[model samples]
Every structure is written in C-alpha cells, then in structure tokens.
Target: MTFKIALIGCGGMGRRHAHGYIELRKYFDTVEMAAVCDVHHDVAGTVAAEIGEATGSTPDIYTDFDEMLGDADLDGIAIVTSTPMHHRFAIKAMEAGLHVITEKPMGLTLKACRQMREVAKKTGMVLAVAENYRRDPMNRLTRALIEAGAIGTPYFALDIGVGSSDGAVMHSTVWRAKKEQAGGAPLDAGVHNADMLIYLLGGVDSVFAEIAINESQRTLRPMNEVAPVLAEMYNHRREDGYDTGDIVEQTAVDTAFAVIRFKSGAIGQLIMTDTSHGQSLGVSTVSGSSGTMYRPRSRSGESPRIVRGDGTEIMGDALLDLVPGFELDDTLSTLWNGARHISSYDMDFRDIDSKILAYEYLDMVQAAESGRQPEVGPQEGMDALALAYALMESGVSKTPVTVEDVAEGRVSEFQDEVDAEMGI
Candidate 1:
C-alpha cells in the first residue's frame, strides 16, 4: 500500500524530507506526497511546485496546517516546524486521526512527551519522533556487532564530529542561537548523538549534565511563549529591545557534554559545541571488551583490518571513510546486499540517508498502533528526556540523580560534562 504523505513546513529540512519521500517511491509500492503546509505561503507554495516538478504529481499546498489536516486526508503529517510549535502541530495532527511523524526532542519536557503519547492512545493514531542517526547503515552494522557480542560486553564510548555545520560556522543555522525555538546545540545536534548512543547501549540508566552560555544576548526576542526571533543576529537588528552587548538568555546552553549510564551496564559520553575556537568537529569511539571502533567526521576504522586476540589479524579491505550510506557502501552492501543505490551515497556527508532510519522509526509507531512492540516509542523519548533532565538536575544540585528520578525532578539540565569538566 502506498502511504499518502503530507509534509508540514518546507524550509531547508522540509525540502530534504520531500526528496526522501520521492526516493522511497521506487523501493516501496507508493509514497504519494498528497499535500504540503507552511505558514509562509511562499515557502510552502514554492516547495510544492518543486516537488511536483520532481515527482510528476503536484501536491496540494496549504497556508495553515489545521485547514490542511481537515481536508487533505493524509496518511500522516511529517512535522518539521519550529520547536515551540511542535506540541501544537503534533497533538493537532494526532487528534485528527492521522498518524504523526514529528521532529525531535518530542517537546521541552517529559510531560510533553507523555501528553503526545496519551493523544496517540486517545485518538488511536501513531506518533513517531524523527531521530535519524540511529538508522545509518554502518551504525546498524555496529549495533549488530554489539548484539552479536563482537564487541564483547559494551562498556564505554565517545561521540565525536567535525564538519561545516558540525564544526565551526555553526551559527549558519541562526535559529539554533535562540532558546525559545532552536533548543541549543544539544537539542539541535547533540541529541542525535544522544539518541544513537542510547539505542546502541540501551536506554539511559543515569545521566549527568551541565550547561553554559557566554555571549552577547542582544540579538533575540521571545516569541509569544513559543519561538521568538534571533534579533541580535548582526544583520537582523531590533529597536531598543536589547542593550548593545547584552546576552540573550534562555534555558539553552552554548556548550554541553554529558555522561549516560545505559541498561547494558555501559556508560556513554556526548559532547556538542556551537563555538569551535581552534577545535574540529569530534569523533565517536566505542570501546568494548573485544575491540574499539573509531569514526571521524567523514570516516571510521583503519585501512587493513588490524590483528585481534590470539594474534590473529582480520585482513579486510584497507578502506576509505566509513560514514553512513554512500561512503560506507562497500561495507553495508557486503553486510546487507548489492541492493544499495549509488545516488545518495556519493556526497561524503556521513549518514546521507538517515531518512531510512527515520522512516523505520515511523514503522515502529505503526507497529505500536498494531498492538505489536515498538522499537522506539514515546516511552523511549520520555526516557531520553528524563535522563537529560536528570543529568541537568544533578548538575545544578551537585548530586547524582538516577534515571528513575526524572519525572519527580524537572529542573532540566542543559549541559553535560560541564559539571565534571568545569568542576562546578
């Protein structure tokens, strides 16, 4: 059966989603993009036309999401709206009896995630959060290895990256600088690492985090308790709103590092930064009893497979970078099959088709709706937020907080590694 998809929001990320849906048409039976929605008529209208040109079928466009929900008869709405509006759009879609695939963090709080889950139950629809990193092909291989005990007993791991957006020049995504909307680097970027980390090691058992923001706050305005504007952005100025050089204040942290304890008795480290003075994007290294695998900005592992225990060298290919999709083709295909598509893999952009994983997550929701087990459902999102919130609480109170303690403790930690790294 072809899934009739309605895309909400057609900004940069939304456009990418449009392309993914079109690509899936070849693999699946049908993936008809029935409609598109965005408050900015120009953005939505333009994207709809672009997609029509690409897919040979024009999708209905909407200026308001509610109206779209009322008339579009969509299978599900892929929400790519701002942070503040997520709760509104998501609940609204679920209430309309359509399944929902929403952008991440679920909401600002664990309570919000629960509210979404309840809505899903009451409305009898599905709600899937998009955390694309967990679906990368090589990452899938890593998960398989860990599950197969190739990594022995999982213990400690580190996440690292350095790229154009992942490294310096991060401010390019200006919305991220504002707290009311973007949710900082942790929510914007680090959360990807956080979610992937949990999937591999299991849900967090405990977390410790600390956050800090030190810069001119003069460039922003609160957006009606939702998402405000980054007015202090040099080009975007406000009149008499903020004194020059004043710091914009939100619950967001400019830099954060966190440590998570997982169900598998393994601990994980996550760090994200918007300010890279002399540094590069980091790498992720998972160290286990058997061996360790290191992945860099656009690559992972060494050329020829190195020797392991019993002095036996595993001589494989002396490969290039091993990111996701295209770059890691030789490995993922060798593991899966030759069914890999050569198009999306050539960009060297790490996990180019994290969308597949995102869709698989959506598939998990469909399963939950069917009364089957959901791989990563609302409970998982709530669990992640709970751990992050707990870590923040621990940092502020100068104590350790267990994962079971998040619902009771809601102060919400904004940074990690800062408590120990900064010793505050």
Candidate 2:
C-alpha cells in the first residue's frame, strides 16, 4: 500500500528516481520516498529536497547508507550508484529487510549479480535490475508487433548503433572512458541494446565481436598553458568544469561489430562505431518468418508498404496501440502530470507499468522471501553479461564466437586488463 524509499547513489539517476516517485505520487495513492543517501551530502540533501517538493516531503538525506538505513523507517531502497557498488548495496538493502530496484547490467561480474540475487531470495525481498530500454516507447511498439505475430517467430536479427556512440553519448561520463569503471562499449553501451535484443529475439546462444580502440579519439590540450591556445572545442568545457577530459587517450574503442546466436533458434548481429554516424530503426533490424521490422522508420505509405516487411504498410503510434491499460488512463485514473500521464494516456492496450519494473526488482527481494518471479530473474542478467563477454572475446580473436564458449571458459585476459587498471 505505502512504500518508504531510500536512494543509495544521489547522482543524476538517483534524482531521476525521485522525480519518477514525485510523478507517481501525484496520481497513485500508494508510494512515497522516505530518505536518500549519497557519498556527497550536498547532492543527497539537494535531491531529498527535490523529492519533498514533488510529494509533500518525507525524505531525510544522509552521507552514509548505513546511517540512513539505521535512522529511517524504510520499506524499499533504490540502488543507483556506480556499477562497482551495486552488488554491495543491493545486499545491504536486502539484509535490512527492504526491497530494491537497481540500475542494470546487474553488477561488474556475473558472480556478483548471482550473489545479490541469492541474498534477496534468502531475505524475502525484491531484486529487479533497471533495464529501462525494454520499456522505451519505440521499443515497446516494436515488441508488440513481434508478439502479435506480426513478425512470425523471429529467425534473424541485427542491432545497429550509428551516430549514437558519438561524443554526445559520453557526456558527463568518466567511468566509461576508463575500463576500470566501465566494461567498454560492449558492456557500457551495448548492454542496453544487447538486453533489448534478448528481450525481442529470445536468449543469445553465441557471440562474435571485433573490438578496436581508436587512438585518434584522444583529446588534446596545448603543451604550453601560458599564452597557449585551445586546439579543440572541447578545451573550453574541460578548462571550465570538465574532469580533465582531454580525450587524453582512447582507452576503449572507435568501433565494434558483433554477431549473436540466440537459443530460440534466432540469430542476432550487431554493428557499432563511434566514428560512424547515421540513423536506423529499432537499434537494428529484426527479421522473422512472418515479417521484418525496420525499427526506426515506421513504414512507407503504400498498399504493401515496407516499414520492415513487405506485407504491412502502416504508420501510426504502435506504442499507443499495443499497451493494455493505456486506453483506461483517461477513463479510470486522474491525469495531472502531462499528456503522457496515466489518466490522460489514450493508449489501446494494457500499459506496461514502469512501476512494475521497480516492483519486480523489489519482487526479486520478495521472491527471495516468497519464491516466485520477481520481475525477471538473476539468470537474465548473467545471460546478458555472458553474451557480451563473449562478444568482447570474439573481437579480440577475429573469429566467430559462441555464448557457450564464454559459459565454458574464463575471460580473465580481458577482465585482468580492466582489473589491473582498476588496481583490483
């Protein structure tokens, strides 16, 4: 009925969760954010203030999570900190008898993710990873068409990321630049697409990747500071407030190509290039026996128009069409936030509640308690990682890779490289 929440990382995402709660509070008669925790007291205090502003207010800000947990009557926690700390905090929150919804990719490794999942089960709490792309409006429509038998049993699929991996994607990010904080593109950027791939195409059975770092992707500063001129436009931002971000080095990649085989008799291929740019649909191409979907562009207007396949040619808001509760918004609920508010949403199908994402993750903790499907399982995270780890390995070898290969072997070489740099 009522949920008391705690925020573990008071970064942008932590604040975003607060914003979501604020929006939900205006309409739902259920939840409230109770407290927030961050390493930086200033950031934590500021976000806590923002949450109160949204929902009347009940949040207490704390610099340390343990202190916040100790002091508050918390019911659930949102772990939105850096990737490295996800496993630890998830465990802490579970042990404290609170539900948790975590940011995705689970943790730094499959082992850690598994451990966190186990604890939630033992503690009778919820553990759901925040893989939000699966819920994207565009992506939601795409999934609906596939499920509606629009795409009959997907056989072949392609994930393409063009122009998207540009500098814009890397803004306000340092962890991704350093392999220590980020697992490079395959893990950092591809994870979203990869997880979505799994969501649409079933499970991945194999992988092959060609990974390369771009030496040219480096940022440059004048060797001479006094009377020195800014060589690149990025210099002004760095000099003013950027984190010494002279792409001083291209630690990760300029481009990457990948192929994935899904266990559901489906094949998936992915292409990603930092230097390359363009636009495509659905992040890639999804081809099935029934039809094919061109993810980005809807469909050409014709008798048998080609949006993706040759059979259906229609352009409309598939997003508004497939959702269940979407149509009930204006009739059943109160619409206050904006046009998209549940009350005013004129969707046709049952709207997928993002609230489910939070609840399901908490369900992981609850399943840990009651034993059932918490939104999804811990294995889903592992499978996603295993597929990515395999792709990274294939990229290095310039050979076709299998997800089973990763399941069978250790990626110590790549991991060691990242770990050594991390001083782990």
| Candidate achieving the largest lDDT | 2
In lDDT terms, how accurate is model 2? 0.59
TM-score of decoy 1: 0.75
Best by TM-score, which number? 2
Q: Each candidate: RMSD to true structure? A: 7.9, 7.2
Query: Residue 234 error for model 2, in Å?
Result: 18
lDDT of 1 by residue, 1-424 (tens): 6567788867656765665665454344445789998887777877788678867888998988878888886777788776556667888887776777777776555555666778987886777776666555445555555565554677788874433222211233344665545456665666567667776778777777665554424243232212222212122212234543334444455566677777778888776665554566666766678766543322222221322346553322222223232333332443223435321233323124434533543464455447553445576666655655564566576666676666433443533232222222
Residue 195's lDDT within candidate 1 is 69
lDDT tens digits, residues 291-341, model 2?
Answer: 676664211111111154555554454434434434222312232223331
Positional deviation of 6 in candidate 2, in angstroms?
A: 0.6
What TM-score, to 2 decimals, does candidate 2 have? 0.76
Off by over 4 Å in 2: 164-169, 215-250, 277-283, 296-312, 317-371, 397-399, 404-412, 417-424
Task: Give candidate 1 misplaced runs (Cα > 4 Å).
Answer: 161-171, 216-251, 296-351, 354-375, 407-424
